[model samples]
Target: MKKIRWLPSQQDSHNRWVVFFSLLMGVLLDSISWSGDWGVAIPDVTPLILLYWVMAIATNNFLVTAFFFGLLHDVLYHTGMGTYALIYCFLLYPMLHLRLQIRNKTLVQMSLFIGVWMLAHQVLVWLITPANHLAMENIAFWFAIPISILLWSFIFLSLRVLRRNMNVR
Candidate 1:
């Protein structure tokens, strides 16, 4: 029988800081509000960032990470407790399961998946919050999906470069 190790090794431990900072950046990006109605067009950056890290790094336990960050998001956004936490966990579960297949996909293919993913996230947010019920009718509400899809390549490439440069396993 094989045993599982929960703790990261000395070298692997360094990646935690990297992942933390990147997710923090995502949090920051998510918190910023765009001027006027443009805000609705901005996609949720944290999840996209989370998706990148989840797909890139296999060893780390992102479910807990996602939960924590999602909690942070809920607090930051002043939403109900466990709202984003539940959403993040729900979204990341399939990604965690299909990480290998997703990792192998080309950037264009990945963007399409990301579009669907973001759409789902938006839908989840709409359903979870009563305030967002009317948002679905707005054109900008749907803009988030395509905007996130466009950002996918940039996020993926930059994070890939960061991981490679940092030598994160």
Candidate 2:
């Protein structure tokens, strides 16, 4: 079996700012958290981006990226402080640890992982949401897990392409 890589893969020689811009795209995408349909729990794009970088790049800086993104996520989305920051870290740590096992897998398999991740996030959100006075009444939130799984391939591909095109580590 291939041993896990705790460090990031080889990176571009220059232009590290591209990585920051790419991550910013994710935080910006979080604005779409709300979907008009009541039955569709929108996939949290920030976590998707966070998981991707933690897995694809495996950089030491990933945690800091997650922290900043998560903080920005909460502020932009108007949720509680440290809410998404904690959630991002929660998902990031595991993905980083498991990256070796799953790195070679196809997107379909990765979607299964994303599905479980989404469920876990929802559970935690349900537990902590009341602190922010948020109500989880929408029937669509139930649909989020499957929707995120189904969309995982697209999201993964898109982010991967962006990462590659930008030559980001």
Candidate 3:
């Protein structure tokens, strides 16, 4: 039997490929997040259900990641091509700046990040979408924020565990 390599030995190289695939996956998932008609009252849960937590925290260059994924989102959804890119850069700026405050905080920190990320995404979408198309009751969807956060926690924790096992800093 071949010996299995430790996570540290393979993480860096594997991380690069994971980032590439994630960009594609992020766009595809976000498109699904936007599809389908809203019926009388129930809130759409896709965005909350499809949170795209990066697999490794160390790969967190929010601007670069955001720009790439946003571009993919725009291309796939056929929206203002660069709009999401700009919004993502703007949204990620604050997150990156506050990185230290969030670093070691525990699951609560991840939960807070999810709420903030969802809020940032919602605000940007609202700001960019034409006022004529606004849906008044879309506000009910904010309740989905917690769900997205819970989803994010799982991904974030998995990445953390993988990184720790690999001795990646």
Candidate 4:
């Protein structure tokens, strides 16, 4: 097996407030889209932000934050208790392993990671969502993937800037 070089960018990043605010922004955005009466596609903000943080900063720390955000998302969105928490927490395993592998410095790579994760997350959401929520069948939910893919670059770049500003590792 080839020994891959993991970049030392994490060593340069260490802004706790940025991490907190970025994750917080993600959850807030998700909630706004969930509760708002918007008629268009809204990207799944949580995972996208989570992916960036996991890839760009401290991957291990995010698992705990993911669980909390998941619970917060569950309660705020009313998608049923533990649903969002479980999904967010469940996603961390992949994120942890994929951390160094996914270099978000490039748009294509970021798109690939975002697309795959969103697809998996949505598919799982479809399967695991409680029966009661099944009633709202078409949520323009299908647009989630493409929208998220398109937004990944913007979010990635924005977070890159945020990371730079905060100096988070």
For model 3, the local distance difference test gives 0.56
Q: How do all models score by TM-score?
A: 0.94, 0.80, 0.67, 0.80
Worst window of 10 by summed lDDT in candidate 2? 7-16
Residue 104 lDDT in candidate 3 = 52
Candidate ordering by lDDT (highest first) = 1, 4, 2, 3
Over 1-169, each residue of candidate 4 has an lDDT whose tens digit, in order, gives: 9977575344434454577788888877876645443333576687788878888765345777788888888887677888887888777778788777777346887697778888787776777777425424667665777888999989988998988776675
Q: Could you tally the backbone clashes for each prediction?
A: 0, 1, 0, 5
Give the per-residue lDDT of model 1 (tens digit) for 30-147.
Answer: 8897888768889988999899989888876599899999999999888898999999998999888888898899999999998888999999998997778889678798899999
Which segments of model 2 are wrong by more than 4 Å?
1-16, 33-40, 131-136
How many pairs of residues collide in model 2?
1
Output the lDDT of residue 161, model 3: 67
Per-residue lDDT over 43-102 for candidate 3, one digit per residue giving the tens place of the 0 to 100 score = 222232223333235355546667776676667556787877787777667666665566
For each candidate in the order shown, give its overall lDDT on alpha carbons. Answer: 0.89, 0.73, 0.56, 0.74
Model 2: per-residue Cα lDDT over 1-169, one tens digit each = 9998775445533334555776677667666546476524776766776677667765454787788888897788677899878887887788878987776888789899889888887777667656423336665666778988997788789878887787766
Displacement of residue 24 (Cα, Å) in model 1 is 0.2
Full-model lDDT, candidate 2: 0.73
Candidate 1 residue runs with Cα over 4 Å from true position: 1-6
